[model samples]
Target: MNKKTSSFLWNLRQLNLNICPFGSSSIRRMMKGDHLELQKPKITYQNSILKNLLLLQSLQKPLLSVRFFCQGVLVFQLEGSEIQKRRLNTLTSASVGKLLYPRQLSSDSQCFFMSDTTPHLAVDGPKKMMVPLEHDLSQKEKQLDFVKHRHLIKHCNSMSDVLDIFSKFPRFSSCNYFISMWKIAKNMSEDQKRFERQLLYEHPAFNQLCDQVMKEAKTVKLQQVIFTLYALIKIGIPQNTYLVQVLLRVVQERINECDETCLSVLSRTLEAMGKSKNVDALRAGLRLLVDKQIWTLEHILTLQTMMKCIGKDAPYPLKKKIEIKALKELDKFSPVNSQHMFGALAALNHRSVILLNECSKMVAADIHGCPFWMLMSILQSCRDLQYQNLDLFTAIADYVTTTFDMWKMKQVLALLLVFESLRFRHIGLMNLFLKRVVDISQSLNQKEILCILHIYSSLNHICDSENQQFLEAITSALNTYLPKMSSFSLLKAVYCFCVLNHFPQEPFNQLFQENIINELLTSGTESERTEYMLHQVNACLELEGTSVLKSTAITLRECSSAPFRSHVDIEEMLLNLLENKRLFLKNVQLPHNYFVDFELRMDSKRSKVFPVSEADAFIAEPDIIRVALLCVSRSAFCFGTTHPRGGLGIKMRHLKALGFHVILVNTWEIKKLDMSLAVTFLKNKIFSQEAFPTAPGFAA
Candidate 1:
């Protein structure tokens, strides 16, 4: 308790304070460990920086790092490139033990929970946890791969060259490159965009790619190189279209090397050109290589393929113009060059009027290069387009008639076109055209004669009363042709006669009486000989006089007894004609018959009529006389000809005219004829005594 004790105690207490609450050794050891622990974070920070730098170096960019500590103890480290690491470093403090950059690459900043006081490097201390950096790293990797693969990098060569390389691989071998190329191509300007996309076709780079695959790779699989180019072209390349055009030209130059395999590839590629921005360029290439003079059949076929691609979607006027130009070049082909001819025809099928007009010019030029078959091909094309243009038809008609000497078949087609044109409102031209045909036929042989007759019959369907003049014209033509020509002339005559008689029905009997028909029926060539006989019968049946039918029946009946009867199919045709005649008779009510019915004007009240002369009357005993009159009454009950009443009337009238008395008897006259008593009275009066009815009480 003394001063000395207090001083000693204070010094001891001070010494104890310096030492520690426990032992000095334990305190010193703890401080050393704390120092090591504090230094540990610096080592971690340096290592992390080095590791992050390595990662960033690999990425070729600067990066930032964030260090985290709990109560001055190192806990975790976050590292990222300068993109966000430096930003993260701004808010987080290493001294605070919680260091986080406010702008972090990942949502999660490097964070540390503090249990003891430690200086904060971050301005706003700590914050909500951010998303993991691992996610960010993964995302960046993917972006890198995509950018690398999805775009046409600067190192990439010309699309054509690239396509050529791809062509060495199998189909779809360059899919990755193709996809990349396509995306890049689509990104190009509107002009380049077209061909680029086309290049991306299944045969990628097809336009640019030399189709000549490596000789070593020749044995590779189907669609290998070709399909690769196809794909590349389809997905497309932006700057490669010119290269594409070049490639196409190269292929076209070496087109002979194309087999079906190559041709098939070319066909597909050309089809894609329809929508290509470089269509004109591609077409130019085709034209340049596939010139008309040296064009092979394959080239024509390729041209056809090109046409099909554009034909439908192309504007009609534009397509028509193109067709005109194409056909002009096509027409230079030789007739024997059937391949060109067929191709030209197929192409012209889409442009009928143009073809027809061109054909007319060729015909007018007296150019014999276009063979009959070729001209026929052109005319055949017109059929599909016939209704759209009449000038084409008229020109064709003129050509047919003018060129008939050169191509008979074309004439037939021309006539057909004319006939069709005439079917609607163009009869003048049709008649003129047909007349020319008829006139020409008459000058030609029987074959040509038959052709005209058939043509006339074909046109006869539209004939009416107004066109009856032409019918006579036709008849005249036939008469001239049939008599002049032999062989089938009889057949022609029969055909004409039947047509004229059934069709015109206008006074052909005069021609019939010329007796050429009778002469032919008697003797004509074996061909149509029976048909000639049938014609005579048909003509007679068609005549106004029944005498013709009587004569015809007798003639045919007599002919049946002859040698030719067994050779003819007479009964079948005759019966057919007879049935036709019967039908005609049923429909045709004669003027005389009309006079008897609706036109007849006898007095209504008169039951009996006086004949023109008394000689028309007849007398008889009462019963017999009554019967006669009843017969007359029955006959006077006129109606349709089918009625029997008229039959009896004619008979009674004849008898009456032959001096027989005929009392008029009808329903009303039945009673007047006589009751039994009157009959008895009449009998006694007429018979008198004895052998008669014993005087009915007037004495025997």
Candidate 2:
């Protein structure tokens, strides 16, 4: 027999079918012919037992001997002579109850007896009975019990049952069935309410529920309306949707009826939406709440929202009241609340030692638990306030090292900026961050990629191998993104590369080509174009040690009437001097103040007259010729202009008094003077004669 048939017979024997009214002769008839064939294999144990009992009741043949016991299968022997005994001996070993019968049964009288729990049955054969072991049975039984428990949770009768089951197995709380049931639950405990909030925010079904609630927005209760809107905002729903408008109208209609909590919620919702038709009502509601001394964490949040929404439009008195109240209740603020409070204070440019210290303590206590964006905001607030706390920076660096993978792209960039702003350095952390940036560089836009490069270049330290690797990755990807870069980003990229002294030639040429510089100069505002041109000239000189693009020079010269006229003049003159062989020197300092346009030193030496210790004896000392180019402004040389002496007279007198030759070139005069005339002017000042003749009274 197969294992299935053996299991069935084993179960039947355990059921003690002999206790029934059926005799051994009936049992023999039941086992005869096709009755066993009528029973299909692999039937369940219960069905097998019932079918066997029914067959026994229908038995027609009688038996000579019949024996029944409580624990084993039934056995019968026929009343006939040797024919019956020989027939029984001819029975196959494949019979269902062959294992249950003992071989010692009397054979001469053609009789046998079957009894339950026969000890001699074991000696017949050990492998014939395929009973399962205790361990396997217990394992299967436990699996069956767990399946039943899951079924109960899935088709729970009520919300109370779901809550009970969830309490027992908190893991099941993530189930969709539980989430749906919890949404419609009428009553819940504090813990249940907190769980519901978490589910409503995280569950995928939340938006569908939001759509439903918003569709029936007019009928939703005030409390439900507030919570539904709050949840939607938390989930980042756009505030300008039609549903948002409906919700806003609902809140506006019920504004007067709302208590402090409801008012705070409405204010925050409106603030998040960044719009409100009834500012007066919101301001008044807040004022009344404050007058009633109903300060809470919600009040602080509402105040923050108001500051953000109204900005400078917020009334002075209302702002003052909110600030005072928030300060008074600073002790009760949580980390999240403190973040908002600090953000609001920073926005208004308000600073307080107590508030800042408290915020620092909260953040230091649980830096890892803080949200990435919140941490960024706190860092930003500190930056804006120029507040520095060593403990806070240490905590932030620790958290970033442990949980950087949890940060988003923008957060990572912002954190880097904070580090740069504070001049904080953690070489290992920065190196790891740069590697991550390079890994994700392909996915970043031109602006984002440039930002990373900019941060790296802006650091005050020297470039290491990791920094060089980051640069290589950026330049390799530069061609793909360079075409889409804005002019500002393009300029910044070039500037960064030049700052690092790691210029990539192809991108540099592409970015600073003649057409691009012309477009920038012609299209940008005077200040912007001037700045770009200046940076282009500086970058080219630093990287290539050559003049700027010809088109850039022409643009600068043609835009003479531009706002940065003097600055443009200075740059052109400096570039020209840099390129000229006669004027080029071992050292040159660019103009930094109103007095000097450019300071140049040549290899020529000269002698200067000096007095020895007031003895009135003259002596000559050798000195290098220091020539200062004073680019005279048009206003300074105008006919009506006044000077202590004459026009350009007092400045020349000062230069002569300082024992140095000064060259005064009129702005108009320099515009007319080309490279040779400029070179001639410089040679005269340095070798032949002073460009400015001394006044009669001045000693020289």
Candidate 3:
């Protein structure tokens, strides 16, 4: 290296490690090439970013580049000024090309691949003869409509701000518009990427762009074509099959011509394809192309993108191949990038604990530094594996509760669901959700409303003022949406009410209408949940003074039961209690297809067992207590917590409304008990007080 350049690099390396905490190994390896090579450094795309910094140091540079952005090797930011931001923007546009700077800005959390060598795929294949690049295409692109509308497009903040501009795309303007708008959109924060992509997908010009790109496929510049495909995906793809095939063909035809820069964008586009889960686009073989080209990729951005693309859908052999590659480049896999690999691994339906632990360590090591999205993914990874890490979850809870406002609605839903799956709860987060949900309740989609109903109901949220408002909003929204909701969804909505111990009379009135009831009965046969709801809804309605909604189409006895049973020992012990204390029937299936551990009818004061065949026959007699011995195993709970799952709670509620004095024989509490203790435990559950305990509030 020349003395001047060598001294500059030496100074960069000698910066205080305690302050920056970034390793320069990649930088050193990149810079070790001869000065001639240093002029055009062979570092991967991520390093190319740093190389831009090396050159742009002549313009201006910030210390540690604003919180040590190590390019997926455990880095974050401190928010630089507008000048530094502009300087960084220039550095990015100049480095990764214009199409990418925005995507890179969209979310730092995305998995990227990087190959130091940047090899083209299938070297042994014969190279095709190169066609001379079209001269007319370049000249025409300069005068495209985007150049004319550049001033107006620059001031466009949201996608709506540019709908008029998008509609005004002249005959030959799509390529420039696609390229320029993507660059402009790059300036949007990461969250807006999802929204704007949807808007662009809905625009008429998107179709025009697709047709235009297909017509110009052979003549347009390769980067323009590749980046346009990437942008089409970011905005969201229309259901256009031909467009995917045409783009796939262009990519295949241009495979050998792709350099590292081209491959970086290509790999990224493939990553988006995988994430978007466009079956047609993937079937177009761009996914297979990435698989074929996997060995050639060494860059972290490219590799992570490859892992992200493979996800769980890739076959076992390919997953193993990429897994080995990930392990080999483990250092390059940051907590965020490692998350993609973890997601892929978990999707295999196998828990790779070693990898799960490794990922946990990365996040735990810098839990405070992890972004909202990254923590959510880690929780998801834990959820998929059924892995429990209290420390990690606690750290995440601490961070998320304080910054609760930062989460998007769907992300918040996912996080809460993950927390439920993990059996972890944070009061602050729950309160925040309840409060936040009420504000946005009016705007939720049908699926989202159902999800909210499930979330709050399953969590067994107390009906505080905030929660009541949220539930009221949800139910009101459902009532408004009833005309549009499918018959099955109406059943689900009613079931959510039953789970919460209420009759959804308003919706139920509409639901019991002849046509909708028939629709639900016919369509509901295929689903276990639907079948359960059919019986439970009717039972709940009747117990609430409404008439039965069951029609001839419904067969109470013919409904499918889960066939799941409790442990044999637990069942035996519970039978012993019923036999020893009271005359009782063992293993009775209720009218609702619910299997009771033991069913024994008693007078209302529970002084003695009765021989009534049907428990409710004596319901009018205040002296009757319909005892249903429910053996609730740990599996029936929310996995790790003592709280019964929603289904269990629902069953208890149904039993209560049937005039049954529900007594829960917790499997865990009696697991270590002898027969005498088990009998005592059973007796206590029945005669504990005047009002028998229902649900998990059973005798201690």
- Model number with the top lDDT: 3
**Residue range with the least summed lDDT across 10 consecutive positions in model 1:** 594-603
- Between candidates 1 and 3, name the one with more favorable TM-score: 3
Q: Runs in model 3 with CA error above 4 Å?
A: 1-266, 272-302, 310-333, 344-350, 364-397, 406-414, 417-426, 437-448, 463-486, 523-528, 543-566, 569-586, 598-635, 656-700
Give model 2's TM-score versus the native structure: 0.45
Against the unseen true structure, what C-alpha lDDT does each candidate score? 0.38, 0.52, 0.60
Off by over 4 Å in 2: 1-257, 291-312, 346-353, 383-391, 402-411, 418-428, 435-445, 465-467, 483-488, 525-530, 533-536, 539-555, 558-700
Model 1, which residues run further than 4 Å from truth?
1-256, 259-375, 382-426, 433-442, 461-489, 502-540, 543-550, 553-700
lDDT of 3: 0.60
Over 455-573, each residue of candidate 1 has an lDDT whose tens digit, in order, gives: 44433433354345555555555555443444335444444444433333322333344365456556645625464345343433534324433343323322222121121122222
Q: Which whole-number lDDT from 0 to 100 does residue 260 have in model 2?
A: 54
Maximum-TM-score candidate: 3
| Global local distance difference test of model 1 | 0.38
lDDT of 2 by residue, 1-700 (tens): 3654555454445433433236556655654543212221211323222243323322312222223212244434333222122222222223424222321221111233232332353433322322332243344344333324345545564444544444444322122333335343435566665665565456555454444444434433575576666645543445666555656666656655666566666666555655445444554554555445435445556556554544445556656766677778776677777767667767656565667777788788877788777887888888787777767877887888778777776876778778767655555567778788678767777777777766666553334767777788878777687777776567667666655556576666776677776666666466655564444444344334334333332324322322323446545555453443333222232321114555554323321211123212222423444565666664453122222112244335434444446666566655777766765554444444432332112122
lDDT of 1 at 125: 23
Q: Model 3 RMSD to the real structure?
A: 18.4
Better of 1 and 2 by TM-score: 2
